[model samples]
Target chain A: MTQAVATNDRATTFDVAAVRADFPILARNVHKKPLVYLDNAASSQKPRQVIEAVDQYYRRHNANVHRGLHTLSDEATAAYEAAREKVRGFINAAEIAEVIFTKGTTEAINLVAASYGRAHLSAGDEVLITYMEHHSNIVPWQMICEQTGAVLRVCPINERGELLLDAFEKLLSDKTRVVAFNHISNALGTVNPVKKMVKMAHAVGAVTVVDGAQAVPHQRIDVRDLDCDFYAFSGHKMFAPTGIGILYGKRYLLEQMPPYQGGGDMIKTVSFEKTVYNELPSKFEAGTPIIAGAVGLGAAVDYLERVGLDAVSAYEHSLLEYGDQRLKSVPGLRMIGDAVDKTSVFSFVMEGAHPHDIGTILSHTGVAVRTGHHCTEPLMKFFKVPGTVRASLAFYNTREEIDQLVDGLAKVREMLL
Target chain B: MNAAAPDLQDLYRRTIKGQAALFSQRRPPAIVTHRCEGSNPNCGDHLALALHLEDVAIAALGFEGESCLICRASAVMMADTLAGATVAQAHEFSRRLDAFLHDGQPLPGPLATTRCLEGVRAYPSRLSCALLPWQTLTRCIQPDPTYATTHLEAKP
Candidate 1:
């Protein structure tokens, strides 16, 4: 474990007030109190740079890409492809062709399930996933298994929300076709050991697909270093516009699989007899892509790069540690997932209070959080609780905000109990 | 028998105190015996509601489970409110309580004693929490041989 000194040295320092200035919505008050937005796991607040990028694209170069040979189209195509290159560099992928854009992580996972899973999976083959997976990751494999007669195998997590690595390794066999799991759980905030999981999956001749929706926004991701066959994350989770995401697939696997959608941009030539598909990325990116969303995502990537991922991760880690200790001091309040290697997500249930009631009371104090099963019903069932209140943090969040949240939860305890 | 009973707010104060006193006095059994199980599987709140009925009135009511405070508090409130009320009155009280919580309407004057639940108006999701015990009691007091003798599961 790295000492606090080393971690502190590596951490990036940011002017929170200036950072908050970049996000216009954070300035507004909710319920007559300054909004303390803590639902970053659901979606992050976009900075001014990303907002301006979307606005600029719409105002200046709002033409369709890949079709028009005109100047506007050329600019749009170049800008859109430039966003792709940014993503390629962001994840340190070997080539630009390996990055395919989709609506979001949900679509990316479905693409893999439909294209890759449908083609390669057969009866008696297994799709391995962890219990901590969000419904997006779990349901796709279930649907694929229903279609292909492949069985879905779940690797369980302990009470602490940490994945049982030994159990996961034991579940792998020659029949395993793919292992799809979240890099960080949206509900529990448990950062799974993906690099080790990928290595184990590879040893058993199975490909790994990581749902990076919760990971990409908080930490540095290198797809090449992860050695994963597929990595999917939503732009919205990374402070970009909604309805746009990136899917990083290994070049060989992506080239081998059929295109996810058949449309204008994905085709080489269309005729009555037959139509051939386009090249690597364009083949997967079917229609007129999310131009504004892509530009916004690129701007978000730039903002994160300027802040430095290592710094962002370190700041969040310290916040989580402080939050954990503070929240623990609240009587009858228990955190749901207490994973040692967790990110700054606090999911907890008050001993005598419903999560919804606690969330409502907290909202009155201008603290916004997600309260429910968080789309992990199996995990909730394992814990034997209805749901938990999830307070997720980002780089812009501060220690004072955590103090406010703790104070708010203390008030909730008084009101309810 | 009724003199426009007391102010509803005063009734609520008394009910809260009465419930607190009753919970403190008996410390109701942690595990219910002669149990009738009711569960809202969707939210994972499971309970065993036990009632002692005599002379067409609820002599006592006790419940055991690990549920949200709303449900548990509502259970304690029910035990305090229904102790002397006839089975018919208990059924009527449950309906009015449900309407007040779910529909956001004021409780009728005769049944306004349960108005401490008004706090629940702000927290809509906990409306189910405040009504679970009452719903269980309604079924517990039904006269039909199967409905009375047999426990039933209520789906949310």
Candidate 2:
């Protein structure tokens, strides 16, 4: 909030320096040191384009969207709906109607659990998820399970934090009415084979819900190609503002499920006897939505498109490789997840220090890293750790910043070990 | 502003580090007499205290948990000082430790090693870590205590 927006796009191939310039917070200092922010999985820093979009929306078209006789209302409605279209195009969803806006990934997942799982699940039925899911993906299904008397089954992960695909398939019986799992682990950075898993779940007549919160920021996501029945992701994790997220459900599924909440925009007609519901997305989005957040997300999708996801993915892969190799210089620091495929997260633990101590030491060095269970308490239990220090990288992060993290780890060793 | 690195070096003194090292050795008793478990839900620091009470007086104390050095140090040092104190003295120690951390009050003789944690008062976020054990010890003396939590704000 303290920085200015500068659209400094130097034309180069995956130029991280130019990319970093677009985000002003990267230029600041924390604790008198150049801030090395590696907490992207928690929520990514926003770019100038996204910030300008939200600013322009409030400045020019500050009005409630959907229906009004005024000009500002019409402009707001067009921009808000245009934002939805941008999101639909970004994820390559088949129809804009399939994209519904919610608060965040948590709300999107809960909407599916409340609307779909509540209607479909019954006593003695099963809802399957992996051990690596965040509490957002886990607790919603548990609530629905408690409501419907359905059993919640967890597909186990291996020691490397990779989902056991064989065990995931074994857990998918005909009784499993819903299957929910993250496309990538926020805590461990293990990228699950979602397309393969979705196919396996569909083979057993179960619909799959993919938590794409961690994946959307790192790679290109084609909902049609992945063929997940429902894909959920947040805007803030992809360089946009918070309070806006997208849930891309199959048209047939969205049409079949009832409304998650009953309010103004969701209803076509309300009488003392009965009320007629509205169309696809509006039927799900019940209230006055986060219009400015949607506009910011739209601009974010544009920025990512202009930058190109393939370039971002390849560059971040190189960064991940460099970080993995460089972090080995730290003594007594061991990685928690050793999956064959990983994104930008480096979750680790030091030998003699607790993660909170490591986190405080890192903070003192002006390096921002998340240190906790990351809302994956069951996964932490599986790994036999209280918590792990997670340094989740973004494309804007440079190799020099990673070296600073290593230096900070040395300070932690000097003080704690 | 740049004094943090040196301040941290000064904070984790020998007494704090030595007492924190004792945290792992301070295990739960096999007899399961007067043992209490508590946790800081914010950072997942679990603390279990085992104490021996001899007719309204404390005879022995030990702790087992994974927390920061400040927390482990506070728990271990408190256990060491309050080992043979009466029940009222244990409560007094807890109250005085709260005062020292919050209001900068000077600690008495047996709690002299606890002075190493004076730096903790500057970081309010770390206060719960230092207070987790004392609160749990308070629960051990309570007749019907279920769980423990550290509330850092001004209480009504």
Candidate 3:
């Protein structure tokens, strides 16, 4: 942060050092050098609050949820359901019943594709997705389409990795039954205009499914304002425990869709001849559920709110600008994504060095960067490169770490070139 | 069980870089008796091994790919060591290399630049990159041409 004109005084005074202290892993040293973690997009490091919350749960409140009349079971069930309520408020969902926990974003999307798409989609219908979608977003639609005889259409993006809105609009038709797209691309940090896209999808009588896995950490999410039918995000990427995610759906649509899985938790009554399903959220939640994960996610929501997402966004936006200028200083480095509204991702490819080799050299310097297509093979194919070296930033990431990354890139040039 | 990460200098030695760069300079064989594509989907490493087998020995060996330095270097070293070697000897080398990488067995005698890749064993992740081409070599020497992928152990 050599220079940053903060939008507000609160934004100006983002104590990154204090924020860094909350994450215990920040003190680590990798390969004899201080750690410079830039792989935030893959998975974020958990804070002490989140860790302690999970610890306290297992230590004190360990029991199966949503069943039993014992005190421990009641406390566990109340804590689990309270986590759902916390999520409902965190994403600004219309109702607590709209939140359904899954293994992660992948399972969240699969629930929509399998339960909703399998029932609503049919042969001769079309499902439109963007080329920049992660495999989680693309593969589920592909499988659902293949099973239902529906057509899968991919909307193209420009060279700078921004969505081609004109092309996206042209691709949307009345036959578009489902529209799936990511809120923010993980590989490239290009932020899609989901509000406008969701409106466009509504105009065509299609449902909007947003992959908000990368968005939830960087910015505040208002599912009610986005008005998307389904929004899926993973807790692990947002500084929570793994195997817990939120799928926020409209209540009416969730009522229409069938149960995603069948087990004790999802059923109201069971019979050999016929079985009735439970209400809104539990119908989709089929198993005993990731209770500890949900508890950790709840505490994570508390942590994010206490930190204030607005200040975090502003701080990261400045870091993004700083990183853009700093990484461009490295010779032979070409940035892969240069979207205007993007935040917290720096993807680039250096000449004469493969991404993995760059990654290896960077790792030695304790600058952990991700190399490869990042599960977005189509995006890599579109960029006409094998893969890009992605150094995704977070709110806790400082400009000094960006300098470390640049120095590591210089080391890469020295050795690999 | 490498307790410490491999040093960068030890991992990306001049031998590895020179072999990888030399592969870039040389072109794959125009025609070959056996050719197979090797792929590592985890890191998007794709390599092709083209060989000309005569009777039982490999007459010529060539490669083409944009894989990482470790992978390309390993592929070139395999080609250089196996040229004019019998198919059975190639299989033996492949087995020895796999065992060396996975089980820390000793590298067989008379290897030129292959010993430079010993640093890869410390990097459990990059071990797949070093083995991608050898795995492709194993599949290429077979009677059937199958697409090869990087794995520590050969599939039965």
Candidate 4:
């Protein structure tokens, strides 16, 4: 394949079909038509490498770790630990111990809320979150505050769906113990200015926790560089299995927090008298871990590494631009979250039709898109509509898919109007 | 050319015409200014059903929202069928409609007009899209005093 030299901020042009070929599911048909999987923000399609990695783990290294003494056991333990290192490097965490595996971002947030919020927060202390947060990010803080008598405060977002940074700064105070926000909005795809937010939160001695579920898969993340106390993300959104996710905390902070779950693997010793929790990451990871999921995530990371994140980001941005142009051409279509810096998720409402109708019509054409509040109900309420049809793209997606979507939308206009 | 031919079968199919005929003038009591809102949280098909009930029978039923063809058509079918029927009859019709959409069995006799929704049998997820309005109507009639208190409680 001929490679065009990169100039400016754009990626050097490459063979798009070759990239699409790596994902096997993309070849499958839905409703007797080619599958144009655009719901990447919900979950991504797995490459053969990630799928095979999980298969290889079950086929070859099928033994449990930490408790076994045999050779297979040793191999399993080493592979599992290696996956942790992969996760550590993926987000640029300071140490592997700081990267704790959870079921997904939702569980990770709950863990922090139950553990840190229970231990550190008290009455009159405030937990600050933004209006743009997903239900996962918002509810956990609300739960924690409800239990602790701590007040929950919100930083509002402007009409563009961008967080009001000045309002956020104004809300910060000595009583603000924590600031939890999504790094990128799953519904709107607006990439929040998280690093700056984290820095500001730190200035007030408030711990910052980022919901990186949408951010990590699309963009390069440097936890150390971002300097957030805690970050949470799901592996499924990053092309891994659904159950596996990572929660990265600062080393010192992770060490201080209590164990989230009381079960096997999290305890060093459990006696009738008292129990001693395991150190660092193990303390957070309770019960039998998602061994196969970790292996799958490691494989996904390996695949992304080989393709190069910069290349993937550039290709996705091009697809986003193409989608924006194509979708804009459709009459009576209004785009939501038209931020200057955004991810490849498009949230829009047709002028006369509801998002549900638009999504249904699109599905008939074999173009799958998410339509509704996108689990950000409060954000939906803020926008004063039930929901919008979201067509989220990934690196493997092409401009042709966007054209199909636009065409499908036009057909919907023809039928509905 | 022949009045008998056009009268033998209305402009549309017998089923469509029958459904349309059954939908004639039955405005609901209190006009149920607010319709039942139902959403399939998984795939995002949301709809609201407004109704006007007259005693035990439905007087007028209309829907204002959007969804897939199956859903929209189902909404139209639901409003048409339930408009002149009692609450219990509406419930039974919804149950049969649900089964039919799920590819279980066809509705018998004139009520078989629901066959139009068979187009959605292949798309199971869209079944919820189609049934959302009906489900919301059921919620409205289920006799919960709290239903009047919360405007958005029926959403699922």
Candidate 5:
């Protein structure tokens, strides 16, 4: 792959300082030191562009959308719809009707489980998921399976955290009604072969649902290209606000499924006797949606587009490699999840210090890494670790910050050991 | 780096770090009668407490699982302090530890070494780590001699 050459040379081209300038939080000191936010897997620091977009919405165009005929309502509706269009284009979904707004990836997954899985799955049906899935992905399927009297099957990962495709193939059967998996593992940073997996799942007549929460930030996602039935992602991880996310489902599928939540907007006409559901996108968005959050997400999309995701992806690849090289110097630091095609995440355990101690120590030096199972408790159990100290990178992150992380880890070792 | 920033030494006191490193003092007995598991959902700190009780007294106690330095150190220190103590005394000790951490009450005489954990109160997020062991203890000895206060009384 040209990944190595492209990233090494593209380093000079990707101006990180310029990107860093756009994020105000990066300038703030954590404790007494410059904030080196390595917890992008959990959430990303928002750019001023997104912050101002939300601010502008509240300051100028604050109104309830879709219902009101006032000027403010019209503007709010226009902006919110514009955000949906942006999201639709961002994921290259088949139609705007397929994009549904929800609270976040967790809720999006739950919606699909409650609506689609409930209707389709039954006793003797199987729901397939991976060992590396976040709790959001795993628990929803479990809840749905439990409700439907369906069985849950897990595709196991190898020692290096790569999905055993052969094992996954073996598990897929005619009884497999749904296959849910993560495009990129939040805990392990393993980039699953989505297209191949989707093809295999389709062979067994299993509809595919991808948890793209961690993938969307590091790579461009095209739901149509992957041929997955449903793609779920969170806005906050992609530099948008919390409490806003998107679920891209195929038009034909969403047309058949019932509304997830029964509320004001999800219904076209409701009476005591009968209730008619709204169309595809509106059917799922039950209540007054996160309007300002949508605007912020649109601005975040605009900012990422301006930077060019190709450059961002390439830059992060180099950063990940550089981080790997630098962290080798940290004696007794055991790297977890070294999958071949992983993205910008490093989960590790130190010999002497606990992951929490490492996190606590590193934060003192202003390196904000995540510690624990990363909402993937099953994966952590598979790896035989209590939890891990994870440093997940973004395009705004610099090599210098990685160096700082390494230094901080060395200090953590010294203090803890 | 800002000079005003809190030092790691403040959180990682020598005694606590030493306790975490040794961990030898925390070992399960040959026969564990009571077992309780506690987990901190936020940071994924999990711990299992095992109590080998003889006639309502803690004959031996130990823990196994993954947790933070504060939690591990606290668990190690806890095992040392509660060995041979009756279930009633164990409950009393938990209340005193809770009061000491939350309400600034003096630690019982036996657990003076655990005072090093007081440093964790400054880092509110780490307080749960320090309390997981105690909470697991409360969960282990239930119904008969309940601890007066909850594990995380202040909800740090």
Candidate 6:
């Protein structure tokens, strides 16, 4: 909402060209045209620094962490643990012990559902989640509820794709055990007021789990300030590698919850009679972790710190505004989400062309976009659309790319209509 | 069908455009012998196919639902071509069409309207759109146990 810092026809706070240079894939062409990637909500392009870090780990420090006493093992273990510290600082978690690594955001949420939800929720209990949540967030709770005999309640969203806080409050009851929702809607880009929602859940004596997969790349997150019991996010969404993510849970809660899975590294000691579990984060991290992925994520955090999230956020907001205005000019193009607080995601449907058709057309022009329900099937039903062509932006994206996207859509209209 | 020539026109040729535009005017039969819904869950396309069988011959064929251009066009052209075909003949045509789309073979005769769709053979990802209706029609006649539910997918 604030004025974008621009000087001499350039965004002063952020330089998109420089950011693009750091990502090697941005230089490549798709279908003989320069690639205009707008699918950051699914996964962001990795920076050269992050890529090098992962490569370096594999080249020099490749070893299974935490067990071997060799020099390579020590370096790998140090880098992997240091990545945990970076994540703890990234979200401002209370302690390093609260940060546990998993495969990705989906696995992180599943971990919480399998452990916390199963242990606490029982018959007649409730798990409240927003309708706009990705299936990863929704289905895990559904599984937990099905197992515990607890009811799963959904908070409604308006036509604008904004969650109805009033409905969320009403859904909260004495038996409400957990409240889980996305910090930003991946399909719609609606930014939920998670802090206020977490407080409301706390009022009902319920713990909150925030899906920060889409939010972490766009804004600076302070988990302690939001006071959510659990926060899950993906590394791939934040310029880190796939198959690596973080789950930040309150120590007191994690201490009581059972381990998500049983495996080698999670055990403290083994005997013929019984096996004692490891402490804190190690208890939750069952198998050998993605050491190289953690190292890559650490480098990505360093890159973001140098670029500054505040500047990145401001530049992206301006781009979102420009994209929204340009997309509105395309005749018969209906924008799906118009939440007041939104990121640089434009989901729309042309009058005659289906989203898949539009996406296929755009792909020819090297304008990559996502076309589907985006795993938010319930939200699609609410909007009365089968799916939408979603163009999600990142800080490295420029205004010219958005112009190309609008031009591509015009071509789609000509061909299909 | 060359991947090197990745043109949008190749996929949305004139034939496909015309068929997609003409789909709305075609009406569904008043009565149906067998009906099933086919969906590409990845892209949220829905195709509801119905058949009217008169002594194992397709007396009338109709469909209702929404999908991408390739899918709509394929469904419309398929219904128009297969109306009077027997169950076995319809399946045979579908088999040949599948072979053509997948193996890059020549499209079979009696499927003249769908020939222009040979362009879709290049775009592997969009191939499912062109095959959705035919697959649904197969389910309608054969009645696979997997597709017994309203929703039918190419794979289990």
Q: What is the C-alpha RMSD of each candidate to the true structure, in Å?
A: 7.2, 4.5, 2.6, 5.6, 3.4, 3.0
DockQ of each: 0.13, 0.38, 0.46, 0.20, 0.45, 0.50
Clashing pairs counted in every model: 0, 0, 0, 10, 0, 0
Give one digit per residue, the lDDT tens place, for model 4 in A1-417. Answer: 333434356547756677678789999876667999988888999998999999999999978878789988888888888999998999999889999999999999999999999999999999999988888998899999999999999999888899988999999999999999999999899999889999999999999999999987788899999999999999999999999999999988888788889988899999999999998888988887999899999998888787778777777777778789889889999888888889899999888676766776677677989877888888887887778899999888877789999999888777656
lDDT of 1 by residue, A82-119 (tens): 99999999999999999999999989999999999999
Predicted structure with the largest DockQ when compared to the true one: 6
Error of 4 at B80 (Å): 3.5
Candidate 3 residue pairs in clash (backbone atoms < 3 Å):
none
A best-first ranking of the candidates according to their TM-score comes to 3, 6, 5, 2, 4, 1
Better of 2 and 4 by lDDT: 2
lDDT of 2 by residue, B1-156 (tens): 355333766776555677888877766645445878777765678888888888888877787767778789888788778877988988888888889988888787778878888777666667788889999988888877657877422110
Q: How well is each residue in A1-417 modelled by candidate 3, as lDDT tens digits? A: 223438566435688888899999999988778999999999999999999999999899889998988988988998898889989999999889999999999999999999999999999999999999999999899999999999999999998899999999999999999999999999999999999999999999999999999999999999999989999999999999988998999999999999988998999999999999999889999889999999999999999999899888888988998999998989999999899889789999999999988998888888998988898989999999998899999888988899999999989988877
Instruction: Report the C-alpha lDDT of model 2 over A1-417, residue by residue, as the tens digit.
Output: 121222234323567878999999989997788999999999999999999999999999989988797999999999999999999999999989999999999999999999998889999999999999999999999999999999999999889989888888888898989999999999999999999999999999999999999999999999999999999999999999999999999999999998999999999999999999999889998889999999999999999999888778877887888899988667798999989999999999999888988887788788999887888889989999998899999989888889999999999888877
lDDT of 1 by residue, B36-140 (tens): 556544344555677677768766778766555456667777777777788889988888888787676677765555677666655455566667777767876
Candidate 4, which CAPRI tier? Answer: incorrect
Off by over 4 Å in 1: A1-12, B1-156
Chain A of candidate 4 gets a TM-score of 0.97
Residue A57 of model 5 has an lDDT of 99
| Predictions in order: lDDT | 0.81, 0.87, 0.88, 0.79, 0.86, 0.88
Q: What is the docking quality class of candidate 5?
A: acceptable
Error of 3 at A212 (Å): 0.2
Model 3: per-residue lDDT, tens digit, B1-156? Answer: 324555667567657888887776545766588888988876889987788888998888888877999988888888788878998898899888878887878888846468788777766778889888888988887888688877433210
Question: Which has the better lDDT: candidate 2, or candidate 5?
Answer: 2
Model 5, which residues run further than 4 Å from truth? A1-12, B1-6, B10-13, B30-33, B52-59, B84-86, B103-110, B144-156
What is the lDDT for A83 in model 4? Answer: 91
